[model samples]
Target: MKPTIVFDLDGTLALGDGPISAYARAIATRIGDDSFGERATVALIAHAAGETSYRDGYHAVATLAAEDRVSAEIVSAAYDDSRALLGTAGATVSPPEGLSGFLHGIVEHASLVLATNAPDAGVTALLEEWAIIDLFDAMHFQVGKPAGLVPILTAALARGRVLSVGDIHEFDLAPAAELGADTALVGPAAARLEVPATMRGRTIADIYERISGWATSAPHTAS
Candidate 1:
């Protein structure tokens, strides 16, 4: 059996601001603040540039909403609303440019897995729309992360080596690392997430060659 390479959904694979914007709209509507979306977008940019302390856009917006005294009940409802729009036209989700090609190139050497805290919502449709659903050997949704990832890693480890990749260290990479799996931390959060990642980069594309090296355990093939 091939080694398993696990990836996170959302910012880690599906990239765009639609989902964030939707989240902002929900919070702003609840708080009656129309400018919340713009402010949240600005904060998201800052987070990506390593200028903010947030883990990512969702975290920034959630924290801001809380600061505004939005109740937990309202906050959760807003989040659920945004999550329901994931992978749809409202969410504006799309794969990183050329990601499909890179993943396909390495598919033969490794078994790819998609694991996320997200509900099944738009996941299947999004993968189908991207025309890359079959690339993954396994798909796990509603994974609680940081803790929920332990069993998945354990199973993968039992088979062979495992590598878990995600933008967030705490939710996506830490547990895997603790279980002795190699990890790749990607996306904006990676800049400030000083975790023990076997590979880290600001974007998936930035570490393509490195991932390929580990996947093939040989010289990386041409991208």
Candidate 2:
């Protein structure tokens, strides 16, 4: 049996907006005015001012949802709409060379999965649009990665070994580490995050090369 590999979407699979930023702009527009750009900027500024928690920065925009500027229904609609936007928003981005091939290769060697915090329906649409839905065997949704790391690892290990990869170590790798799963950190560390000495995981700057190695070594096949 091959290892099970759990991957993060956003900055991990493709370059795109962070979770907070994606909803921030949309929620702002629905609340303030028809001008999404301007309203988003204002909400972002307020968030930077420490008016709200970073994870719920969109809440700052939601506050304005009570205004007569737009109906609450419109504001609620923005949540799903914004998530769909993240799918096509990063099209011009140049994926790491051979990234698709790497992902395909990895899928062959392991049980591949997408584990992200994104709302399920929206992220599914995005991955389908990217034409990478087949590369993964499963997809885990909102609030699943950090704390859910143990279950993922346990299930994956039932078949073989497990490797967890993601953009934010604080949100992705720390919890995986607690379960003693191998880890790969994709992006920069948070300002307040501490790096553990003798970390069991590896830091990977290139997702393609890493997945390629895993693919070539495992025993799996993909459509």
Per-prediction TM-score to the true structure, in the order listed: 0.92, 0.65
Backbone collisions counted per model? 0, 2
Enumerate residue pairs that collide in model 2: 108-220, 109-218
lDDT of 1 by residue, 121-181 (tens): 8789888888789999889998998788899899999998888889888888889878888
Best by TM-score: 1
* Whole-model Cα lDDT of every candidate shown, in order: 0.84, 0.58
Clashing pairs in 1: none
Segments in model 1 whose C-alpha atoms lie over 4 Å from true places: 218-223
